[model samples]
Target: MPRLWTTRLLTALLLALLLLTAACEAEPEPRRYDFAIQLNGGPTGWPVWVEELTFDHTWWSPGGNLGGGFDKRPPSGGATAVLSRPMPAPSSVQARWFSYRTQTFYEIDLELPNTDALLQQWYRDYPPPDYRHYLMAGFSGEGEVYVWWRARCTVCGRDRSRDFHAPIVESAWAEEAEGDPGRYRNRTQEYVNEGVIPSPW
Candidate 1:
């Protein structure tokens, strides 16, 4: 890894650890709203190959579960999951992705994508009788991760909750990309070196 990105990853990891240590202690209070993660963005022509994907959330929320657990993995399209309660939105993605640019599967801590614009879109979507809050993140050839602040009340006519929180995701949501199989597998092996995920090849 380049020095800059290595530094970025280290710094992000340390910060996330600190936040988790501090925030996990507090009991997450149940709120009026629930949370959701809608994931679907990927490479234009190729299916997204997810190795590992997790949201680095820095807040107190119940179960800290993001989405109904990415029910649909990559190459099969994205999925939506409903979690417990709303807290602050996730700050970044600690994920491993297969890069179409280099044909390399690598991991990094990436910040959320299209945040400012997404917030703008969020504002435009709500504030009448009912509204929703949302945030987003995406990477090159990587799936986009979105967390929604939605209404938990089934009886409520309008989605009154508008605060989003996020993660502790299912890494399996990432799947093998459709490409040169042997090459991709070989490179993945080189990168992983007999780690948690056994090589299918």
Candidate 2:
């Protein structure tokens, strides 16, 4: 038992060191958001837990139905999740997906393909079996709000596969709101004011 305890402690220490390294070596700046809420499957019964990660991004609002934006659906039928970010550059955008249930993170790369052509290809290639829908509250450096999807390729396994990319369509930022009493309400209003609904991939 003592030996087992020592092994566990060593493993924990190693993991902590890795996370610390990632945090320390980050580039640009970090993005702040409310929570990556899971509206379906295992998260159905549990109250949502919000986690904050450091990244570069802009703040955007939620317009379309969360599930309609991409291919993956929450294990549950109806999923409504809201997250926030400070702002990011406009040159190009990409994202990383983390499966909390599995404790794994996957990187997704996006290429600005023709919107119509990309959508048609997405329908034929990145079918329901391959990709999933994700919502991000992004902030553009110029105070624009953008929302998009992290499409997962079905052909490749999560680790080996290429992240789904979509053409840029809709992007905007939330407008300034007068003083609001409730924090959640204020945040929701912020999302509504600057929120964007990207075309479903």
Which candidate number maximizes lDDT?
A: 1
lDDT of 1 by residue, 57-172 (tens): 34321121121223232212234444566544455666555643345454555554334344444445543234433322233343443333332233345543433233223232
**What lDDT tens digits, residue by residue, belong to model 2 across residues 75-129?**
2223444454322223334443222222222332333323434444554665555
Q: For model 1, which pairs clash? A: 50-174, 67-81, 68-81, 68-82, 113-137
**Prediction 1 TM-score vs. true:** 0.36
TM-score per model over all chains: 0.36, 0.29
| Candidate 1: segments with Cα more than 4 A from true spot | 1-33, 57-78, 99-102, 111-129, 142-201
Count clashes in each candidate, considering only residues at least 3 apart in sequence or on different chains: 5, 20
Against the correct fold, how does model 2 do in TM-score?
0.29
- Per-candidate Cα lDDT values, in order, are 0.42, 0.36
